[model samples]
Target: MTHLFSKLSLYNSARYPANAARPLLEIHVLQPRQVFTLAAATALAPVAIDLYLPSSVGMARELGVDAGAAGLAVSVFLFGLAAGQLVIGPLSDRVGRRPTILGGLACFILAAGVASQANSLPVLLTARLFQALGACSVLLSSRAMVSDRLDPPSAARLFSMLSLIGGAAPVLAPIIGALLAELGGWRACFFFMAVFGFTVLTAATVLLPESRSAETSAAARSESPVEAYLTLLKNREFQLYLIAGGANGAAFFTYLGNSASVFQDVYGVSPFAFSIMVALNAGALVWANQINRRLLKQHSLLAVLRMSGRNAGLLAAAFALMALSGVTALPLLLGLVFLMVGSVAPVQANTLASVMGIGRARAGSAGALLGAAIFALGALASSIAGYFYDHTARPLTLVTAVFLAITSLALG
Candidate 1:
């Protein structure tokens, strides 16, 4: 709730630690193919966010529980992701990126295997929690890896590409899950996730180079978890960016958590049809992501933020007005939805680059804290959206509109 913008001046002169440790291999060490592989590894955890969405309804029937409670499993995973990132982010800084990610991937694989075997709702939920914990390494460390090896401008460009892949995965996963479920069953989705995690684990072990520099500055060397957090808390712009980012994430989670019921119970649409809607949003985001890359080349990161933040605000306001006027036609709503989500990747990548750019010596910590905060915000949003599931799309529209308003204010 604190105003992060007020503290912007405090970090204006901040710089990456000149004495920071270096990567074992230079950024120039890897081929383009290897970089893409690493990027894919980093994106898998985000893919997990929506990979299971198409299966939520089927999962409820199989687990003998109501859909809402089964939906809680997704929220639980988010909680784990938030909490795990908090630890892994700081831990990676203390030790190294490789160890933390490898450990997390191992746990993720174990959890997926366990989830695939779960026969009851509670067991399944617990398995998902662990799965999120494991996935955190991939999510958090991937960013840290790039931050460690590349300068801010280069990192921003790389992150844009990473955002593209991460955004695409979630958008496409539902389609995959729906097809697999229609052919196999809900359990098959988890099985596929396990296999995917295994592939990432293998790739990470083979391709991920260590990146903790031995020449880290005094601040980097002396920073404890407490100090890392205290620094972020006291910084105004960081807090503002964090809140905006988290609110945006909550909006996404609102869509994700409630999609099953919204698609099936409300619209009476098949999973495949629902996935097409999701894909449309993702495609819009992909286009937006590419635009951001071009914009970044021509403008400062701040310019991108101002453009995206304002544009998203205007669009979200329009959507809210339409919903308020009871324009509930499916095409109208889907068009609004796609427009709202279009800003997601651009806004997130820019905000993250801005926030982490300020804490060059401790980007891992910055990334971890931000990731956790967004997940917490997302869990809260998911819970609220789930509560208002009246077999209508109104709940999603209302929640997303609220988040957009909050983000607009925060960004301003």
Candidate 2:
């Protein structure tokens, strides 16, 4: 979309390349129509990230890089996610969510195109950084919109739904990524990503409303970003939930950064088998979300968070012990892995809802910081896990266990 023209003058350069003057079709913003759309929009992050998991080894081999460097791609994406949210979240409060997120989607599409053509690891990693920035924009915007419309209870249910939807992305991501990698190689993944980005952008451009109200924009403008960040930082409750979320997020990221390597390299699983295993395990998350939603009826938010944290901690610790014992049986590790991923739902959703409640007035900013904490902590943990890779799952499992303990301590 080129905005050289006024509201009526905007045209999609992607659609009508021969005529830059062609008007883009306007889809009136009927926001209730975007309910599933918004949740789907948030799925792009996992789609972008996990959709390439199976392709990492192929990508590394083609680029003449080692496994660690290839794994660092995930860490790189997390860093960009953290940085992007920190910059875009507060800005959305002032400028409005739609434009900020649309800009991000454009960046994502461009980066995916660049990644498809990248010949070196550096080029690919650079492209991934911008892609994460784009992903965070959608994620932050979608979360802010939820905050705009819902109270804590309702927000939790919606977030649970998001988890249920997002978990499906990983189920599909691995299968598609492996198939694409086999047929057309790793570059195919990026091609798919570019197409996905364009579709999301079009839908968002048409369906997304300006969720940031004029008064909130004015209020946001009253303070500098530094002061706005400081205000949130001074609140201890926000800090507690932020750390809790970050640690839990780190645990998940650690699993992601190393899971492929451990399964494919150590266990000698075929790419096809690996894809099915990942997909089946992902169902745990969907199941967990439904359980979480129901439990919210019987228990308090914090109570759910504590239970999830405790369960996740046990799962991670069990994974580490199994790895240390040289257990390579797919059934044992896969079951443990399923439980670990499942336990992520309540902790992440509840902690996130609690923080958003604390900073609802600054939803954009609060969402940004919370997202940043998760990604930043995740990047650090994943990088650390990648560094210690020893052709075994120990590195990933141990790191997940340590981070989940940190999360459990916060919940305690």
Candidate 3:
């Protein structure tokens, strides 16, 4: 497997000489602490989004807005995430990874502080957007830095490990937010995020080393961002992998957009109970991601992806049927949701590694484009789900099914 990755690396280097140069500090093996730090930094976006989820209803009522209108905060934040990656990916390539991450973290801390003080829906929405922008930098930089350090197979394994580590955020954030909301209202969630961002910023500044070499950074800076992206866009493999990744991501985003309403409003679960259900679902996803990492050692990434894709399609269909039939069984509904969401991990991990392999020289731009496409499609899907919510799970189920089916077809 290492030989295979070495051959692939050689092929990539032969194709993109600019990315072929060795960094000053070559990492033959990664320390556990290093992986944890990078994964924690990358987890910022999920934490920022999920940590305040339990407060959505309370926030809506406090600001005198409808639930659907409050949901637009998520959509706008996703849009900002997409837009930020477009700029930050290239900037990181040019300016180096560490500085860009620190700058973005500073912005994230400031935005979260501002969000805590928001007096209206629009103000909160704007603050969320800025917060997402900052988080996007962390996301892109972490992935790019990993790609810089490892071969494709190793990178894929690292991505899975990161997902496993970061998965705790989705499992824990909502529960924490529920407690905070109970004690101090929605604003408390934002305050917590600000403090969290500050901690990550300090840690990153003190511990994270610059991954991009001076020569490589200088070479990346020589090209215009548009040209860099255009170079990656021309690759056929990148396009297919991007589509696969984006479609899978849309399924998860659709779920995120409506799960709170489905559990709280439709199923009549209390806010605290809803958070527990969400945490359980996230725990299932984390378990599946770990399985994917193990499977990679035995099966090819593409093989795992194909199997997961089929499973996702079948689960999506079942979920849609259950929603349409108005199945009121919470256990069955949550089970289907769990399987469908879990199936995305292998697909996302493999497809992202494949996409990064294609444009190894312009990893930052490649990662940015991939992240942007996922979030852009996700924002669109989530907005559509929110708009057609109708206090039922139909919109969520239908959207998830469509995206999952698309991902299956794309992978096939």
Candidate 4:
């Protein structure tokens, strides 16, 4: 890990000397442990959301609500995540990354604890929203910290690295949730999330370094969030990149909102089997992210985005056709979903790098906007898919295909 960081550091120094003046938390080289810590922090929201997915139906039954209302919990969480990023992103720039993250983690811990005790749909939804809000702080700040430390290309790689680490959350979270739900109940999932949040908070408080210096913090404070956002919005390239990234994210969100119901309720798969299926898709995503990191070494980011966007579109179309044709086989549908969703990493990584590159001085704001856009679109997609649930995967596939088509057009 030390050797890899040195190589990346040397490459960045040679490729972009301007980055030499940037305030990095690590003075010499970034340690692998630091990367893992930051990545884990960023994974909080996804882990929290995914960890409870397998228990959504059970939660609804226990809470005496409809499945749609249960699914609304996921959408509400995404909305909170979007809202939080809008606030936390700029706040991190003004106050520094470390404090912003710790503050967010604290909120997440409290929210998770609240959620564990929730006996009604409204209370559970509210708690999930707060949990998302807290997690977004860590998510946005982690990206900004990477931008603060690395140049555009290296930052892109770091984003891919973070995704690689985060991808595991989907794979493992559901399995854990399944076991807990089976052994204890849906509430046990929330209790586990609370404990996880507390652990991450402690680790971040002790190990995470502050990337934004006092000077940068002061300068960031001088500008209002509105002004910063306005300036970023004026950049056409950034807007394009944001749309492309958001579109791909929307596809993933569509899947997340509908997959559990489609696999478990519609297809009659057991919770354990459903967890394994989800893990398989997440494994594919992780593999694709690793491939994206490798591709970055030999190709331009835009080139990678264009290629990924095209491939994702093709895969989504194939999946849509399969769904519409009444083909409900688990293995076939899962394989198509794997390729289509896995294609997101390259497009997202490059688009984010482009967005942050345009506003190097305000990377936090850029990251916030990017994060907000992704989750906002995600919330929209999830809500639409969940509302139109027809006891099949068609709704999910159709929404995913539309988003993939949009992503392809945006990349072009």
> Of the candidates shown, which would achieve the greatest lDDT relative to the real structure?
4
| Model 4 poorest 10 in a row by lDDT | 19-28
**1-412 per-residue lDDT for model 1 (tens digits):** 0121122212222333447543475554555555666667666666676677777888898888877776698789888888988888778777777888788888888888888788998898889898998888777877887776555555676687766655667677878878878877877778888888888788878887787666333455697887887887788988888888888777777777777777677778777787777777778777887788788879987777777678768866876787577666877777777777777777788777767776767877888888998888888888888887776788778888888877777776
Q: Which candidate ranks first by TM-score, i.e. highest?
A: 4
On residues 210-253, what C-alpha lDDT tens digit does candidate 4 reach at each position? 88855557758789999999999998888888898898898988
Error of 1 at 250 (Å): 1.2
Worst 10 residues of 2 by lDDT: 1-10
Q: Per-residue lDDT tens digits of candidate 3, residues 35-87?
A: 67788898898888788888888898899987777677778888998899899
In candidate 2, what are the lDDT values of residues 121-205, reduced to their tens digit? Answer: 8899999999999889888988887766555665786688777766778788889989998999989999999998898889888
Q: Give TM per candidate.
A: 0.91, 0.90, 0.92, 0.95
Candidate scoring better on TM-score of 2 and 3 = 3
Ranking by lDDT: 4, 3, 2, 1
Off by over 4 Å in 3: 1-21, 326-328
Ranking, TM-score, top scorer first: 4, 3, 1, 2
1 versus 4: better lDDT goes to: 4
After TM-score superposition, the amount by which residue 287's alpha carbon in candidate 2 deviates from its true location, in angstroms, is 1.4
